[model samples]
Target: MANQGPKSQTILVVGGGIAGVTAAIEAAETGYDVILLERGPALGGRVAQLNRYFPKLCHPTCGLEINFQRIRKLKNLRVVTMASVAGVKGEKGDYTVSVSVSPRYVNANCTACGACAEATDMEVDSPFNYGLSKTKAAYLPHEHAFPMRYVVAPSAIGTPEADKIKAACKYDAVDLEDKGEDFEVNCGAVIWATGWEPYDPEKLESYNYNLSADIVSNVQMERLANHDGPTGGKIVRPSNGEPVKKVAMIQCAGSRDLNHLPYCSRICCLGSLKHAVYVREQYEDAQVDIYYIDLRAHDKLEAFYQRVAADPQVNFVKSKPASIRIDEEGRPVLCGENTITRELYEAPYDLVVLATGMKPAASEGYVPDIAMEQDEYGFLVPSVEGDGGIIPAGVASGPLDVSMSVQSATAAALKAIQAVGPKS
Candidate 1:
């Protein structure tokens, strides 16, 4: 593709999620100049937040490492993290875009050293750690994270540690004076793959997610299951840190409900099932139960479901738990009617995981002036006209698995390339 000569075409990809990353890689491979913007500190997006992906059941780092390598090798692709698209001008074949990038203190020169961390006494709840763990003022996002650099949380740095960190950095990469900058770029096409954020469980007061310690979201479950997780990969009751003997997965926590997200987040069901298996593997004595309206596994996913179900430790209950409450001893109690039995009953467990759904990241006031269409749910809808000016992929368009997200990203890249048109 390099033999086609340098085509002065540019495509701007918004969001650093799996879809955005895939689109950038594919477009750059096809010889189009690609620019990727991410609102987070790094480019892995929500995919990076996940523990093990389904289908292949591979750790996210396994696949993301390969993409990170590709990004390192692709000289034409430029990624701007901790950045946001401020505005847009022009249209179609040519557009002028302005972006605002926040200061991360440390930069590419960062060697992921613990020096800054050692010098700082400030501690904050790590959102990247799913709120289960804490990190120092200066810390890497995670072990084996791309860019392999420490990011200084300016907000978390207190006055004393802030000054200490400034003095501790040996490479002079720490730039507390580095304010955010805005710049413009010219692009022929744009891709919207901002991806989704987990639905806030506080909306469902019935689950008492914020009030109860044992009630956690699927994302939190991933952190609990990861070897480097809060509990060192031990599935335990959050209330007492006791090894959990019984676990329950509540599917459609914020999804498939008319009151919240009316659409079925396609991945939650399978994701919960996969976590169920993880729980069983960790605790042989653990009895795992999944409460759902339906299995909802599509295509080849049913095969994995069958394999997991046959494991004998998992039980599928076809009823949504109406309420989750803590018992006198701090155990989780699920109250709901079993559709098969047509009887109201309560099942007690040591842990309860809400298989929450995904919602558009743009809901939090992150959209730029690209003039694209979104569904009623705010998911970006790709143009059917094949004009190639705008591209949409991944959960930002709708809920989809990682495999499907990657495939959609490839399609979006092709569309972006075609939008550049053939050189005369």
Candidate 2:
């Protein structure tokens, strides 16, 4: 697949998460042809769902803007969203890839207008909104979403509503007949940056998350806290429209347990603490309690932890919540033994948030012929020599904070460039 006498080689970066995006950008800037494949409809990965990143409290859009601009200007980089790597062939220097792309009804002509959304009758629970809100069949994934285009869910739109949407769009960006296509590309190396998913709380029956309205996960809390959220940034009890007065944050809900995920997720403790601070900020009078077996705050995170603890409105309890049940009025009652006090107590709260652990993304199963290793926890195993043709980065490799994820991604890109050597 060498182009000529002396030129850069091609690299494929799978999974358009932060790590994948960084790898593609770095490789492309080094004069290599880079193909970025994302299973989702857009880039930015899990980080996109987050409202503000920790340490600096930077907005998600702020961090993503640089990469978006770089990708737009780079001629050697091609981003294919709604696509997955189906299979692979050949060796490291020259590999053949089969990419499967999904259909997005809208194209580059989309103007981010709300006309199609206003005309559509279908309403589906928005995954981007974390199920806290509803979106029409023709919807933009999120505010400040990349490509700044709206996509239509064919399954969500009926034939009648679909016709109306086509009529509503003044720009003919809606491609009604666009079907998914598959193609092959030749690349010298591959980078596996597939990210993680939140541990399903339904597996933890003791919390009764699926059955209770007030009990929610950290991700759901994000949606609740977002100004563009379903409730317009109101922290209210799901059972009623009343404001949440008391909030309880549970740490390590699905992590650090031998029966579940054996290793510490590394980010849960700090994430819970961050959410606790968020709750207090949302309701100045709200009493916030954080229950945890151990508060594992690494590096500079301890400073943030100390600041939150110094807040008079916050309570830090060292204990793992044994059970959670709802009261008559839909308040959450948390039962656990306070390890320090050695006393069992049941406290009622207007709302409860479980800091769930991360798992491999659904796209992990679609990885091509790469024989990459994964830990028992389903996280992708990193290469020992740091020279694996497939480089793992970000949350896909393990639990890491936003800054750490970005650092790891840059390192992965360097390794990919090393693998490709001096091009052809």
Candidate 3:
């Protein structure tokens, strides 16, 4: 029999979000060959899309830039974008994983010049903006994209628009013929850091997200407040470009509900609090009302909650809104029972942000076919005591905010190192 130990010490980290990036960087900096794969066109992940983080409210780009610098300095690490694992085979330290790479239709020779984007009139719903804006057929994923590369939408292929884009790239980086291809990566340890997606608010049915333009989800609120966002960092009404002075933040919109996620998302509370901060920072006279079954700020976050609560402009209401209705004047009216006061109330706001919970990326489909084990909630577990060389990092392990995800990613990187450590 072949010697049953790690075939190679190479570590493959799937998902190039904050967690995956941290795992890969940590392992590689520690003298390990690491492969970091991102299923998107860039590596910043959801955090990149945010205006700022909670607690300090620092711009996400600050952290991302530091991480990017670390990544650039690591010689043993290779970053791959637009790639996902279709399957994972073999055992700990001897794994062969199939990778499916989607076509970016842009080649490595390209400099991130705006000529291609300027040449195309065809526009697509900007996923980076969470459908709040549109972008040219050939566009950059975001300004802070790690590779700082451009992507050509599939719709632009096989047309005059494609030719225009190709001709526009003076360096000849546009590859219209670039169809996605599949390949394999051989590694000893695998870290799954697939992140989370926001729960759909429309399912609430009572929230009336579809009926009103002002009822925005918390993530979209992030975009709306971002300087690079569709509204150019202004917290304004979507229906009309009027400044927002009154806002309601609904917490646990889909979390801790037996009918919905059934667990505390752990981030929405802090996120909504941050949203309130954003509003207060933008409008000094803005009145912000936060509705929650119970406040979830724990440990260090308690201070943040306290500080925000101290703001007289910010009101913390103890209730789960029964439903939101649009008045004839296009105002979002929140109707709910105030559990604390035992009263029914209806309030109107120019903008209402829903703090929806997070749903795991692996919740439904496309988990790697390996010894990976999933919990009742679909978050990936160590296949077997993590000895099987499959370790789950960040939100892939459970619901975690940014800071916790980094710590979790570091722990998973250490575990991965041990899994491929010196042989017995």
**Top TM-score prediction, candidate number:** 3
User: Compared with the true structure, what per-residue lDDT tens digits does model 1 show for residues 348-395?
Assistant: 898999999998886666554355667789888754554557777777
Looking at model 1, report the run of 10 residues with the lowest lDDT sum: 1-10
Residues 1-424, model 2: lDDT tens digits: 3341222267888888788888899888988888899888888888888766675556777778889999999998888888988887765666778888888888888999889999988887897877777899889988877768888886854578788888899999888877889998777678878888888888778999976778988888877877877777777887676898889999989888776667788888888777877778788799999998889888878888898889998898999999998777667799989999999999999888999988767334765435466666676765354336767778887887777888888888887788778855
The best candidate by lDDT is: 3
TM-score (C-alpha, index-matched) for candidate 1: 0.95
Per-candidate RMSD, Å: 2.6, 2.3, 2.4
Worst 10 residues of 2 by lDDT: 1-10
TM-score order of candidates, best first? 3, 1, 2
Q: By lDDT, is 2 or 3 better? A: 3
For candidate 3, write residues 77-190 as lDDT tens digits. 999999999988888879888999999999898789889999989999999888888999999999878899999999889989999999999998999989899997888899
**Would you list the rank order by lDDT, best first?**
3, 1, 2
Give the better candidate number (1 or 3) by lDDT: 3
